[model samples]
Target: MPQPAGFAFLERDGVVVITHHGRTATTLRGARAADFLEDVEDGDAQEIMARLTGNYRRGNERQARNHPRNKGR
Candidate 1:
C-alpha cells in the first residue's frame, strides 16, 4: 500500500496535536503523548498517525470484495 501523506504532529506543553491536511484529527495527552513520541522515533510516523486518526486501511479490501458472499455485488 502507498504510504499515507499529509499527516503531521506538534508537541507542546505535554500535549501532542495530530493533523491531517491542515485539520486537527486527534490530540494526545500524558501517557498517550509520551508513547506516541516514542513510537514515532522508532517507526514510520505517517503510518502511526494514520492509524491513530482512523484513516488507515485494514489490508482486507480485496479479500472482502472477492469473497463468495460479495462476489456479485
Candidate 2:
C-alpha cells in the first residue's frame, strides 16, 4: 500500500481540525482532540490522521476486486 500524504492538522482553542488535500475532513474537540494530539505525538501522524478521517485502505480491495463472484463486471 502507498503511504498517505497531504494530511495536515491544526489545533486551536481545544479544537483540532484535520484536513486532507487542503480540504476539511473532520474536526476533533475536547477529549478527542487531546487524544488525537497524544496519538500524533506517539506514532505516525499521517497514518493516524488517515485512519481517523476514514481515508486509509483496508488492504482488501485487490482481493475483493479479483474474487470469482466479482469477475467480469
CA RMSD (A), model 1: 5.4
Model 2 TM-score on a 0 to 1 scale = 0.74
How many clashing residue pairs appear in each of the predictions shown?
0, 0
Clashing pairs in 2: none
lDDT by residue for model 2 (1-73), tens? 9998899999999999999878888999999999999999999999999999994455699999999999999
Please give the lDDT score for candidate 2. 0.92
In terms of lDDT, the poorest run of 10 residues in model 1 is 50-59
* Least accurate 10 contiguous residues by lDDT in model 2: 50-59
TM-score to true structure, per model:
0.72, 0.74
Tens digits of per-residue lDDT for model 1, 1-73: 8889999999999999999888888999999999999999999999999988894445699989999999779
lDDT of each: 0.91, 0.92
RMSD of each: 5.4, 5.1
Summed over model 1, clashes come to: 0
